[model samples]
Target: MSVKRHAFVTEENSISCSQTEQTTVQKTETGSKFTCQQCGRSFAAKGNLKVHMRVHTGERPYSCAQCGTSFTRKGSLNAHMRTHPGESPYICKLCEKSFSRKESLKAHMRRHAGVKPFTCVQCGNNFTRKESLKYHMRIHTREKRFKCRQCGTSFSDKNHLKDHVMTHAGETPFMCDHCGKTCSNKANLEIHRRIHTGEKPFTCPQCGKSFTAKGNLQTHIRIHTGEKPYTCARCEKSFTYQRDLKRHDSDPFNCALCNKNFLLPTHLRIHLRRHAYARPYFCSLCGKSFRWLGSLKWHQKVCICAKTLLPEF
Candidate 1:
């Protein structure tokens, strides 16, 4: 029995040794000896496996000196460093636009070539960039990963969440040069600047009417199509704009100062002017200012100057 046990142990050791030798030979041939223990992924170089391990380990050794932004790979760190000094090495030949990274230049070239390589499987929509497609997918998935802590408002996009958070803090970083008006984002500031510049870049094809914003142009196009997307749940009334639907559903506007309620926004605006002591309507004869047109007319009727001027006319 002891002799049989010894022979079995020897055979098992020999088999293990043969398998190890075969694996080493295969690694020598293929040049992929370095394998990740965590993920079981094979790499040709030892340095590559070490770098790949950082993903699982959550290690970011390469960090930017200027911004202190850490990256897993040295190549990514080098690419990010260019953004600090505004050093754009990659240049577009057609538009003469410079990009910090080669990948950005390639994406810009796709616009010139009219090439959309990345496509959505669900919607069949094509995008120039993979990141844009990923963001678009969140719409179909109804995934609201980014949520505002203050308002409990959820946004699918991270940048949208960032912009929404600024509203809670009352942080307006973007300032309009023309009006000195502050906006939450640069896009809003640009649109506000268009009021001064009269730059209507978005034009309707059917009506030939131009709008300052692309969203306004899209809404204008709906007028030709007769498409009312915003529908009231209670009244079943459809509206071209979402704001109209909101107004239809909303209660009478209440004044915060006087506790007065108004049905129309115009009436609310006039009422607010009274509270603010803003007498915009002026009497032509007396040179007196009144908050409302009715008040101005009543003042002109009793004015001595108006009575004398009326007899002269």
Candidate 2:
């Protein structure tokens, strides 16, 4: 049998003998082909070696016009352009759901077909995708690939690392349109927007009461479950939330304006309001103002005082 050989493509996409000479190819007993010069990964053909070289070289020739995201292959760039227009060419016949890429449709089809090909040898757990299995295997091996540039904290996944870095930087990318509030993540902002939209997605199974956030739903479920995650160190009393636990602590945080101490920082903030001269809330009836809403409501009911009142909040 004649041994099949092909010329390797250069960085410029031209087949060059000099580029092929850079890499060494050794055939194994099973007829393995080309090996990587850097990583020692074996490839069947010289063309595949040329494509795989981009991984080590960080060479991305293909780019999308919409987002300007570069890709190693031209096919990846073409698929990325479909995402800009929200165009899904591949449609599943089972549910008539659309996907931008064929691979996504295939993954979706696996969910309906109940097919899990990727399996972990150690745990014997099955996953729908290979990447899911790879992530799961990190638990057994304790492999952390992603590292923070700022804090030097390592994470197994990129998403967790991104979340950790946000705490260090105090970066709030997601913003609310109504209240001008900002959040570190999109999910938190989405939950905050529910306060305005009144859209409750998380529902309690026991009481049928709905909440804007899943955390709130989980906390509600804890009422039925009787699960108290937070506890006081001194009293050994349990609470549902951290705020409730802090509330039980007597006089921890102190007011900067006054010498009086409070359990919570929020109580200190309310105490500091009494020292401020600015009474922002104006009464239309008396043309007078007050600092606290409770004082204003009290003034509206009983007091016909002509002067502005800065009551002790």
Candidate 3:
């Protein structure tokens, strides 16, 4: 029995060694035979080599079941499946909002905690995800790898590439049943439906202001924190809202004081507020009043004569 066991062990070792040598030899031969003609690159398997050929030939065999989106690989098809499924399995523990993938769920959680883990190596600008970091890095690299086939618009991300493709196909998969309005994407359709449903789930933590869109909620939060992201190119004056900066920069309403144009009518009205002699900003020193705060401040600074003025404006 001991002799038989020794013989079996020796045979198993010999077979394993032979198999390893065969694998190595086969890999070298396979690499040499089925290498890419365009890029001069080798793939491990013949199927992978065929798929790599699609890069040169611009072939997309695998198509989407829902919208007939042609893709190079099965993995892309699987990812695209989530769009139709609307089955967000990955749920954020912080907000309890479900996302299709783990990465998306992680990004969604970042908004709740205000975390930007990924930072740009060149500019030190922060992003919530590595994909966004990659997109930002492209700005430093000046690399636009993805290009649109229809209009030649370039993007840093793959999703943007796919979205551009939809423009050529004229495919709007997401449709509203209530109003019969079509949207290019499901996310857009959802936001459009909010107009009819009157649903504003995103609430500001600082203020009780609600927003139908998450992007709007994000912008509104900046108001409470006084974080102005948009800036004027001419004067370099920053504003909490893009519209505010645009109005300030473009001057649509034609300010009567500065003789400048403004974008919004309300901004021009506010500028008019400074000129109106309504005593909006009152002086506490001599119980005096002025139309503008600057005038009241100036009076308070050099108030020697008016010791006792009218109590009310």
Candidate 4:
């Protein structure tokens, strides 16, 4: 008989994804005393067997107070709580970067170590994390396990299915403080906040330039590597960024702040800056200020008063 003793470790300030961690079970010489009714798995302790039954019953007893999201384990709830305030306690030793969860830090460590532990047997694809490998396996298996009860739509992951169902529900749970705009997910809200905060954390490896999102950094990295990852589904045309792909298809990216449309999200982000009072460029001769770099460059060439600033450049 195996007696699994549950040990709960809580982070001091931040929320972690790991919840209700169970340590190595203490195996006894005595025969199995506790047996799970659903799976017929025997355990030494009745409490261990009871918690294990949640797998069969699909019961998430613990829930977040702020988001009203439920979790099967207490540790998951602990981790989910950190997302609300954006507190990340888990930090990487090499780069000293803090992550919202320990698992995320562990995954980030792979990038520094160049570790590819998980491999796909079917396609020889390698991934840093096990969950990513499992996600990749769906490509080979064509597994759409997360089925939507409302519609006939299915997804490879639970979160994807959850997001798909929200489209039908039309519920915008996450909202922006600055623009009062709303989104379906918390991640989107975080990305939107970067516009107001002007926080660009993701930096280019080749260049010292930074961006608000990792996706933007990836697109910028493609510029150095000459990697065109985005492809048009209609004509099979490739693009370095998704915004370029949309632009090639004549799709306009619209700004919510002003009813004006642009070709890229970067353009929309820049367009949003017009709504805010941000003057980073200055003309030495006229003491004139501009919000954008292009405007200042044009002023240097066209404006006679901007002649003195050319020496600084």
Candidate 5:
């Protein structure tokens, strides 16, 4: 009886066979006839191998017509199409939260189950999803693959780069209904809406203080934890906030008339307005002027003179 041997090329760019007992040959077992030339991954069918080759080639044949998002597989593009029509077939029983895909619902279930399968070997941090672990690994690797063409700024996440790109174009699609204020992104607009609604969802357990945003809550927690992550390079002084460290490194903005020093340029500009007696803000009802907009708003609230004046058309 004669035995047939399978051969494949490896990372070293050398051809090796199963007779030589190479690791590449081990993967070619279980009757996987079709193999990927670039990654040495074996597949059962020729069509499967051809589809797998798209990973190395970065070829996304399946594209979304609604959002222009490209996917390697047809199934992935089909799953993405549900998002456009707000079709969420998968729903969590615990929280009643809906997801477009089954895999997303499965990952969300892990949070309820307290199951973290993916873990970083370097930091020992566990994540429920594989994609989350992949993004977290970039912190240790310092690999920022996504770069902005407009400002040359690099981001670890593609979504963050997408948000940063909008700043360059001055795109403020998300607007607040209360104050007519506009925000660059939907998340920022949601946070800005909390100010009008007086909603503080993130609460500090230690101090019992509440914050509108998660980032602000995290910063508030550092006050109790004494975690000063930002440090000044010049004086080696640490601060809880990056803005404080920047102020420590920067020269003080001095007032020419009073010789007073301010940490920020905006503070100095406001102080200069005091020296110049500049009252830019004025009340339309009473025709009363004030140095600051806050003062003008406060005076308008208590100003009974508006009652005596006739209404303007």
Candidate 6:
């Protein structure tokens, strides 16, 4: 009897080799053919082939004892059990990061410097994980499937809803070992520790400005890149930063020359420099002048532009 083999396409598009040998059954004087109803694929044994049929049908009959993750076959269940033991045979060549699954190691290697190969077809946004792509789909659908148990706040993603629920519960699970300070998220706690440790991990490539958080560093990059995402509602003036937008929106005083309004007195004073002329104090030497007497005195002492004759203080 010839031994039959099976194959399965994994998440990475690689074919998984068959683990078990196929058993053929005899019917009457000849051989009996058994077919899997789900995938329309034929098999030898009803039991051994039943597991193989689950692979094509995307069915997970066997479940994990720890995490309750279901698998198509017992071999897959055995392979998943290694995840609970934290034993990863796959290692990335770029970053030297170990992953429980070979597919995970491939994804982790992309984050070494910066690489986003998988892009969304709908929005053209790139993401490292396929799960991220799934979550991003909800943004287009405007689907709020996950709801917070506390305040009934609905979010499209479960993680976002979980974050929202934390605010209502006031649950600060991440506590600093150095200090008693607590934070709702572990990443936020890690960023907040920089205040005590004086650590700035995120630095701008354009300017030498440093920030504790990557988001702040991204915003700082826009200052040099001149990428304005914020805009004013009243005047429709765009600004690179939110603080600039707020200042532009809240300005009370308007410039007489350009007719532009500014939030601070210093900003208005700087704008006045472009239009201002007629230096009142005149030089006794060349008739050169300045707007302020202090400027005239400095010019007169230097003997460069003009000398303003001062009477008495």
lDDT of each: 0.72, 0.70, 0.66, 0.70, 0.74, 0.65
Per-residue lDDT of 1-313 in model 2, one digit per residue for the tens? 1124433222322222464444333433354466665545567876687776675565778988777777768886887778764678898999988889788899889989999999888646677888888886775555789986556779998877756656654555568999999875666789899999999998998999999988689668878877565655654556666566666676667555554668778877777777887686777767788888787888777764534453544
Residue 113 CA displacement from its true place in model 4, Å = 2.5
lDDT, model 4, position 2 = 22
Model 4: weakest 10-residue lDDT segment is: 6-15
Candidate 1 whole-model C-alpha lDDT, 0 to 1: 0.72
TM-score of each: 0.42, 0.37, 0.46, 0.42, 0.44, 0.42
Residue 270 miss distance in model 3 (angstroms):
16
Give the per-residue lDDT of model 6 (tens digit) for 230-273: 64555556667767666767896778667688878987876686
Task: Give candidate 6 misplaced runs (Cα > 4 Å).
Answer: 1-90, 100-161, 233-236, 250-313
Using lDDT as the measure, the top candidate is 5
Backbone clash pairs for candidate 4 read: 16-79, 19-75, 19-76, 20-75
Better of 1 and 6 by lDDT: 1
Best by TM-score: 3
RMSD in angstroms, candidate 4? 20.0
TM-score of 3: 0.46
Query: What root-mean-square deviation over C-alphas does model 3 reach?
Result: 18.3
Arrange candidates by lDDT, descending: 5, 1, 2, 4, 3, 6
Model 3 lDDT tens row, 37-64: 4445456665676675565555778898
Query: Any runs in candidate 2 off by more than 4 Å, and if so which?
Result: 1-81, 84-86, 166-171, 178-181, 184-188, 191-313
| lDDT by residue for model 4 (241-299), tens | 75776676674565566546576888877777778877879976787899988898888
User: What are the per-residue Cα lDDT tens digits for candidate 1 across 1-313?
Assistant: 2322322231111222343342111122344265554445556765676676665555779999998867768997898788764678888999988889799999999989999999977647677999978876774455799876556789988878767756655566668877789986667889999999999999998989999999799779878977665655554556678677667667366677865557888888988987788999998887889887898888987888887777653
Single out the weakest 10-residue window by summed lDDT for candidate 6: 5-14
Worst 10 residues of 1 by lDDT: 6-15
Candidate 1 ranges beyond 4 A from true positions: 1-86, 202-211, 214-313
Please tell me which model should have the higher TM-score, number 2 or number 4.
Answer: 4
**What lDDT is obtained when candidate 6 is compared to the true structure?**
0.65
